[model samples]
Target chain A: MQNLVDHTVEINKLLARYGVKFGIYKNQEFHEQLFPFDAIPRVITHEEYSELEKGLIQRVDALNAFLKDIYSEKKIVKDNVVPEDFIFASSGYLPQCEGIIPPKGIYSHISGIDLVQAKDKSWYILEDNLRIPSGASYPLIARELCRRAAPGTFKENNVVDNRNYHKLLKETMDYVNCGGISVIMTPGRYNAAYFEHSYLAERSGCVLAMYNDLFVEKNQLFYRDYKGENKKVGVIYRRISDEFLDPMSFNSESVIGVPNLMDVYRAGNVAIVNAPGNGIADDKGIYYFVPKMIKYYLNEEPILKNAPTYLPFYEEDRKYVLDNLEKLVIKDVAEAGGYGVVFGSDLSKEKLEDMKQLIINESRRFIAQEVIDFLDLDIMENGEPVPRKADLRAFVLSGKETKVWASGLTRFSRNPDSFVVNSSQGGGFKDTWVLSR
Target chain B: MGIISIEKANNLYWLGRYTERVFTTLRKFYRIFDSMIDFDDAEMVYSEYCQRLSIPNIYTSGQQFVDCYIFDPKNPDSLYHNMERAYDNAIVLRDELSSNVVSYIQLALDAIASAKGTAAPLFQLQQVVDYLFAFWGCVDDYVENEECRNIMKTGKYAERIDLYIRLQYHTKDIEKEFTKFVNRMKKTNMHCNLDKLAELTEIINTKKEFNTEYQEALNCLQGIVEVV
Candidate 1:
């Protein structure tokens, strides 16, 4: 472990050589920056991992069931477990996918659930990212470099191998494949996660394609080559957002989308991983209902608990949120990637009053939660160890079965005072190692 | 083997051209630097380079030429621009080549960025040359797929020939590089006309003045293009 700490500088230099970077846009200009890596590994015991694996599978299964039910029957909405307006009025509920079942009947196939352990040693689910989650690539590459930097570190401990993410991804694509080739469709190389898109394609033996490379001809998706050759694509793990996926069906102004891809998908000639409209389940407001969903769909109690959250959408909940506006963390339901998160204690008295009024006026737009006293991880800064806010994004893949990858991306805030650990927010990352018993 | 998209093919071809442009220009600039030690009238060489590459002359003096042509990213024909083009080409084709080969280009670009505006610019130039040589060597040794190797060799030979002609090297040197180029082309299954090679050989052996018979070399290039 001391050897691992000593070689941190060399490990980081090697990461730079491999171009392990993330892109962020500021004022409409794209800039690529390395996501800093901490030498310390977040160690998880095998027994704890087993418990987490069960909980993650239960949560993802419930989310998938919730999506299937929402798109097909609306039984949960009709039963009044959740408000009818919440489902129909969500900006994420796409009418285009109504009654259309994806191949293999799986939605949210690849889910990234963000979690944090509280001071009391209880893990709380922070958010769910069912819609094209990034950051899995960061840890995947980091582990490889770490092994090279400190080969003896693995011999000393029984850390489960986490490099099978690509293999697991390939199997997921294969399970849902209509019949032909699997392709990872990207908007272009300028996308923030373009490295992930291309790297996953190479590792999974899938074709990395751009919008121009794919075309919908005769109601089938085909990847066109330079020599006028076309290969039929059966499953496409598209990195672009749903709105920019098909120009004809969604955002008509989008040049990055295929014109008639939705029609091909509608015809059941291809499968789209984590099918479109999964954003409805990943909504921050909807996050408060996931534990209930696990019980409702799986007929089993949720093993992991969500942070004590209150949606101002309800009259009773709104009254409570308004009174405790100074103590809770107010989040805009539609925002993600560490944006639109406002800590109640960080706000001025006047701002808190204004937030209470806004929640009263438009209660559906906000969800307030009691901030969990999350445990801090130690990161080396200068020459000494400093504690920083960190959160884990555990990837749960639902192929024929839902299983959690042994490793998770543990991102820590570089700013000691800040709690946001999003890579887009200038945070650093560490590899989470689940020890094998 | 032939999985490259049309856009990538075009990129690969241009990447070949641009990388060759940088390599040949750097070699040519070394001679210009040597001439500058004796003659103060070395600015004309920059203008000649700009003309040969079909880029606009934006520099006014030798200092400006070094700044604009060697380091300027905005100038499409600058060495920085050529390296950027090469980086773009290599980025999309990573699966076709060894990962180490792509890393070399990335390292070269990083070296260029860090070395720009320094007093010792030629020190950085040496690093870029070394990286390009490593890139080719890695491709030859590590890249196993024959088609991938052929496409890269095609680009390399095509660019080398273009650079050799543009630099106006002596007939002896041109013949030597041209034979190496032809040999690589043949190995890659991209053969050229034997008649053109014979004609070039005749010109190299008989013609004493290289500048007077530039049209004959241009015709030989035209023949090679037809073969490709």
Candidate 2:
């Protein structure tokens, strides 16, 4: 472990050499910045991992069930386990995806469930990312480099190897593949997660594609080659959003979308990973009902806890949120990547009043949660160890079965005062080492 | 790896072109830079260098030429710009090239970027050449797709021959590059005008002085492979 800490600089240099970076647009110019890596491992005991594994698998299973029901039967709505307005009014709920069942009936093939440990050692679910969740590649690649830097440390510890993420991802695609080839479709190099898209494609042995490389012909999705020939694509693990997936189907002005692709998908000629309408299941407002969903769909109580969230859409919850505005963290339901998150305690008197008014008017637009004091993790800073705010994104894959990858992406905030640990918000990450014992 | 997309093929081709362009031009600038150090023959050699490459005479003095030609981000014909272009193309092709193979180009780009405004710019720029050499070697050793390799190498040898011709290399030197170019072009699935290729080869291997008819050869080489 000490050896891993000592070789942090060398590992970071290696990461830079491999061009491991994420792109961000500031002032309308795209800049690729290397994702900073912290050397320390976030160690989880074998027994604790067992509990998390059970909880994550149960959580993802319920989410997948909810998506299937929402898109087809509307059973959850009829039963009142989840409300009607939360389903229909969500921007995540695509009317275009109704009644369309993906192959294998799996919506979120790969689920990134954000979790944090409280100082009391209780784990709370922060958010769920079902639509093209990234960050697995960060820990996967970092662990490989860490092992090379400190082989003895790995030998001494019982940490589970996370290099099998690509294999698990491949199996998920293979399980859902209908016929021909598996392709990873990316928007382009300018995308924030382009490096992860390309790296996963390379590791998983899938064809990395852009919209120009793909076309829909004869009610089938095909990848075009340099020779102007087309090869049928059976499964596409697309990294682009649903709106930018098919120009004709969703956003008509999307130049990055493959035109008429949704028609092919609806025809069942190809499989789209995580399916298109998955945003509904991972919507921030939708998150409040997940534990209820687990009981409603799976007939079991949730093993993990939600962060005492309050959906402002409810009159009772809205009144509570308005009164406790200074204590709760407000999240804009529509935004992601650590954006649109406002800490009420950090707001001014005028802004706090404005927020209370806005919540009263557009109650469905936000969800409020009691801010949890995160269990800080130690990271190397200027050659000394210091604790920082961090959260883990545990990847749960629903393929032939739902399983949690032993490793998770642990992102920590560099600023001492901030609790936002997203890579886009200037957070550094560490590898989550789940002990095999 | 078995299938190549149109965008990737174009990027691989341009990546080859841009990298070879930087590697060859930077080496050429080294020779011209050494002559310019004498102070009297500065503008004359750089002027001829610019004319050979067919770029504008944008520099007013030797210092500006050395600075802008090697380091200026604004100069389109500068080594920095071409290296940046190579990076732009290479950055998007990580899956095909593999990150290990792409790292060499990254190393070269990093070298060129840090070499800017340094005390010993030429010495620092030598690492760019060394890294580019490593890039080619790593590609051959690691890349499994023969078509991808051939596509990128076609751009390499084609740009190399084009540069050799414009720089007025001897007919034998030009013929050696032409053979490698023809071999790689034939292996690629890229649609090429073989007649244009034959004419270009004839111009090089007519056992005649290539310097006399290099423009005609350059014209024939332009549309041989539609991408580059």
Candidate 3:
């Protein structure tokens, strides 16, 4: 609405007043910058959102099934649905997680599935973030501020209230809580998503904790209270990475990790939301198999489609990718936050040759996909509406039942020529308004 | 959410101390600055301030004193330094204090940073004090956890009394602050050394001896509350 658009500066000031920011490290020095908010929301019709909700629920359910299978039985891999190499060779695979079924049998408790709609109105998932997915808090808080900024805009729009994200998150945590208190663990204040970590904790009524504040005693995780008392912690929604989560289990040099936390988790004494080693399911190379996973796990056709993709690991797909190298997009499996994506059209000829050789040498590390002609959303530039490339990250929470949040974080590239819509890469975000109608 | 970690409680306490430190010292500096306008004893005024605070005489001139003491980030005794420390502590306690309460510290920090460029720097500095007041008010309104608020208030009163003694305030003023500080300490879950509190009380109640025995009172007050 124009009313919301007119108060862009005012909305941003309130965001600053609430210290809404993301941290970035450049040249080894940390700088916290405000995540710019665009007032023109990315609205979805009720019919379209209905379709998306079913597809997202189906997709996340399949992903959850795959994660459980990968960690325990490996039935999907054994049945030749997903390759053995994709399970073992992927960097996200942790041997320690094997045979350790998480509480409630849910792995990807909070999934941020990135999707982009084409010019033809068909949606394609960009990628799945199963491990420590962020940005939900950004849109969650933005919607609150937007409502405050333009009450009339919300009244006129009939937007579904997206403020229940924390409630959804808390329910997800509570469902898996073994017996005690729930806590949200952060690496520290310097993390890029620290604002979300602390903000979510505040909203969800969970104690925000650092590694030092938590310890394991008698295979039970406990939070050390100020009075030298210990309170049992049954659920930990950790924001730290898998490698830096438990020093004894994963990266031994991780000072940010709580020592022996994996022991506690493995004993079924505590629950770690989005169970560790989820990277294997969300791997870019494994993305090619999600549709098959939906079919394999749910026995249903995928409601949504993946971007036409080719895993260079396969000889047939490798040939197609090499022949159409310039026309496709290349993504490294190990990199995230929009760092390792290379549009074939953007690369020089010499660079293309180097990339082709690198892909040939390390076929398992890359996946190429046809560039989706995604729709460009309008963002106010100067005084006029200008079209910019944007992507939506829909949060799907897997508790007792899988549910798709109505609203999502719609991030847009600030640069006209760029397609990387990640906050770490200087992207601004808009609130995604799913119409109640 | 209600139960706080030891680290958060410490941060809350220090956040209180640092913000109150800036608020009290800056007001004291303003008084000293006011007296400097007609008198030619600017150096004398600053030197006495440094002696009272027991900080190194790092400033060479009155203008340098004003600039460094109020605005310098490098000077440990500077208002900017204390404000930064307050923010550093406040930033991590967002969950305990809530973002609305934490934003006040940020606003106060921003106010101090903006005051550096103004012609009437002292006038601009008043904004910092106003924001600090708002920070406390917001904390009271929004921070639902009682122990967190009590710990922070304890730190606030503790710093107030410490600074009052260092600046050689009137005994009656110190007595009023001491009573409030004891009240907050009692409300907190943190262990308070009752013996030390009693000793600090005895020294303060000896009204005529209070001024001469103030150093001992300061020592007693510092150890009265233990983090354990």
Best by DockQ: 2
Fraction of the real A/B interface contacts present in each candidate? 0.30, 0.77, 0.84
Tell me which of candidates 1 and 3 scores higher on lDDT: 3
The total of clashing pairs for model 3 equals: 0
User: A93-136, model 3: which lDDT tens digit per residue?
Assistant: 99999999999999999999999999999999999999999999
**Model 1: per-residue Cα lDDT over A270-377, one tens digit each:** 999879999999988899999889888999999999999998988888889988888899999889889999999999999998888889888889999999998999
lDDT agreement with native, every candidate: 0.83, 0.92, 0.92
The TM-score between candidate 3 and the true structure equals: 0.97
Could you tell me the lDDT of residue A160 within candidate 3?
98
Give Cα distance to truth, residue B144, candidate 1, Å.
Answer: 4.5
Residue A193's lDDT within candidate 3 is: 93
Q: Per-residue lDDT tens digits of candidate 3, residues B90-132?
A: 9999888998899999898888988996899999999988999
Tell me the deviation in Å of residue A149 in model 2: 0.9
In model 2, the number of clashes is: 0
Give the better candidate number (1 or 2) by DockQ: 2
Return the lDDT, model 3, position A353: 94
Question: How would you class the docking of model 3?
Answer: high
Better of 1 and 3 by TM-score: 3
